[model samples]
Target: MNADGMRGGGRTLAAVDPAPEPPRVGPGAVLRQWFHGEHGVAPIVVGLVLVWVVLAAIAPDFLSAENLVNLTLQSVPVGVIALGVVLVLLVGQIDLSVGSVSGLAAAIVAVGTVTAGWPFALGVLVALACGMAVGLVYGVLSTRLGLPSFVITLAGLLFFAGVQLRVLGPLGSINLPFESWFVRAVQQGFLDPRVAWVLVAVWVLAYLGTQIWARERRRRAELSCVPWSQVVLRTGALALVLSATVGYLSTARGVGYSVVLFVVLVIIADVALRRTRWGRSVRAVGSDRRAALLSGVAVHRTVVSCFVACTTLAALGGILAAGRLGAANQGTGGADTYLTAIAAAVIGGTSLFGGRGSAWSALLGVLVIQSVANGLTLLDLDQATRFMVTGAVLLGAIIVDMLVRRRRQEA
Candidate 1:
């Protein structure tokens, strides 16, 4: 194959196939292809870097301290929602109910604490647990009952909304005290700018170290050892952006509490789906249920777990929404959070067909979607215009994915 063909083929092969031998390609091209193959996040990262540069040039205030912190806060919640979507996408399913579940969770938290006088901590836990429980139920229905996740979670979207209305009853709005530690932590920035950089360092070190350790273990087991240079280059590339971005944002107003929570959620989720035995089975079942069954993977269990994980995360997003909104109302999740969540996942590079995605992709996707949304809204554009633009972006993502898929088959 020619180098361009090899480059096109290398990406999809990364997740599902072994690293192939190089064809006729220059050393520089080989390195570029390898980097793109292993880290699907790189393209999105470049896009983000470009965005920062353009936005800063166009609107000097775009990189100002206040705006930077707000951007982090905004990015964080979407990142959280995307994490849940990633799990479902990995398992070859889609949950349309996440946006609704998010609304439901926020309504419950607001109603339980603000209206019903429940403790803030207990209310938050209950909201989150309930969201997770609802997800688990959907998983059972989809896996045990053999209903499609599309239909199941779609029903869940409505079901959860009704639950939200019932909880909010009569008075659709209530006040939540901002003094509580949990509330403050979820809403306000912690770890001022300097500490935010330190936290980012910890995240980079821990993530790379864990992956390197895994590569070493594989080498010991006679599995392919991803080259040391490959690991180093990828890690360094990631560190450059992460360190710079975190430093820039922290200097503005320190890292937003929501962004930190978002990062933590993504890490937990990525680990759960990619690092665990259950995570393996989830991917296996999604890629091919029959093959998974033949290989002794619990196809049913994996499917159910994937659904449960997705819904629970959806619920968590709803709670985060409540924090951002400062109340639960008819309008809280009414902004099509569910659709956006799906769009964010799909556009962030999650496969619509199943068995290919990453949690980090969700974060990146959300950033893209929200950046566009926010940028448009700032120009005083109408809702119709925004929706039309969003539709185009979503369509573009699907096209890229299909093109990538076709190229993979050809290879």
Candidate 2:
């Protein structure tokens, strides 16, 4: 038994005997309560459902497959960006430069493909590399110069906007070179429908395998673990969503390349944050930077890695935007992209101040935001009304977060 770092508040840290359960709480009841808990994802989940129900009631076509597919596809860029933000949040940092970083990446890809006669694949890679470089520079500045991310990335927002304008130059936008076969392929391409089936199969197997392995590891460590039944139910539901989405989208546009990119980015971020030792260090540092330092975690390195994650994701998002739009320009990654990304992370229940979050939060949050946007369009809502609604959604999430925090304080 030890207090570790607990100061006097009449509470001391100490090991305790196993406390008996108050009673046998049913799994369903437990889950219900969990969903209502401060850290639970229930509020957002329920809000999403309520939005769908409201829209469906108002507009019969709101739930059409075509519209649904469009919604999912539209979610990609923001989700990709939010995926990066998740890493930054996990490590207790922020990156306002993602908007500009993504724009720069889009510009790089456009220049590489159209101006430099580069293959689309290679151009896209280079664009991502450039984004990583920018992120690394941001990390360096924040660490070495001791500047806050808010100010540093705020500067980046301005600098990258200027650079994007310079790249756009005389022409506002540049279509990729069709003279190059690869460039043509990049714009006018789609994945095979069968690929969706393959993806579903692979995801199911991988999820089950991971669940089993995790349970085994927890048992070996003599700690609480996700129950097998619960895992199966949760995994099954997720699989249904993924498979249905993929199958439907593949049928819609033969599978959007942007959607594929989103999935991969989410998977990679999840792995990086959950399965890596660096991730553990990041979580520790985020939860309590001073405690983590005492425990030998390198605070500077964790912060740097978070920026690396942010910039890298921003780059990937930029490429996706470029690919989906078929061009790049001064406004390549402007508008509500950054707002939506941050909003998604927040709605997905990531704490604004960090210390608790998961990479998959991006997917959940992005989908909710995009779905609302899509629904608004389907309902033919006016631009002003749409803006109001979007703001409300974000504000609602923030309010819920504050309430959750206050409740925790009371407890």
TM-score of candidate 1 versus the correct structure, residues matched by position: 0.87
lDDT of 2 by residue, 311-338 (tens): 8888888877776677787788887677
Clashing pairs in 1: 65-252, 92-354, 102-318
List runs of model 2 lying over 4 Å from the truth: 1-25, 29-39, 178-190, 217-227, 247-251, 404-411
Task: Encode model 1's per-residue lDDT on 138-177: one tens digit a residue.
Answer: 8788777889888887788788778777777888765566
Can you tell me which runs of candidate 1 are displaced by over 4 Å?
A: 1-39, 47-60, 211-224
**Per-prediction TM-score:** 0.87, 0.87
lDDT of 1 at 135: 76
Span of 10 residues, lowest total lDDT, candidate 2:
1-10
Candidate 1: global Cα-lDDT? 0.72
Local accuracy by lDDT, each model:
0.72, 0.75
